[model samples]
Target: MTSFFLIDDDVAARCMLATIIEDSDLGRVVGEAEDGYEMEETVIRYAPDMLIIDYLMPKQDGIETIRRLSGLGYAGM
Candidate 1:
């Protein structure tokens, strides 16, 4: 089964996304975060198959997060 890591400032949105993913048999939620800052470690640890990140966040945005992850050699989809 595919695994997913979710990143969003809104808890409700994360919950909803998890529900949708699971209900649709798309994947399992392996981890989640409220922001994009300092998430490389957790992401690496989890090594999920996919990442669902929100575009706007309080600390860091999704684009920057993806770039940072890419630099860190995280090649998840």
Candidate 2:
């Protein structure tokens, strides 16, 4: 199963997506964060194979989050 990381501002959205992904056999939820700033360490620690991120979030938007993740050498799809 594909390991997945979720990044979203809403706790409910993250939970919902995790459930849907797992329930549909799309992937496995490895970790989650509420925003970009809170995700750096978790991303590195979990090293998920896929990332499903929100387009809009506080502290840092998806674009910035992508950049940060890229800078950290993450190649998750």
Best by TM-score: 1
Tens digits of per-residue lDDT for model 1 on 1-77?
99999999999999999999999999899999999999888998899999999999989999999999999889899
Candidate RMSDs in Å, in order, are 0.6, 1.1
* Superposed model 2: Cα runs more than 4 Å off: none
lDDT of 2 by residue, 1-77 (tens): 89999999999999899999999999899988888875777898898999888989988999998998899898878
lDDT of 2: 0.89
**Predictions in order: lDDT:** 0.96, 0.89
Clashing pairs in 1: none
Using all chains and alpha carbons, the TM-scores for the candidates as numbered come to 0.96, 0.91
Query: In model 2, how large is the Cα lDDT of residue 21?
Result: 95
Give the C-alpha lDDT of model 1: 0.96
The candidate scoring highest on lDDT is 1
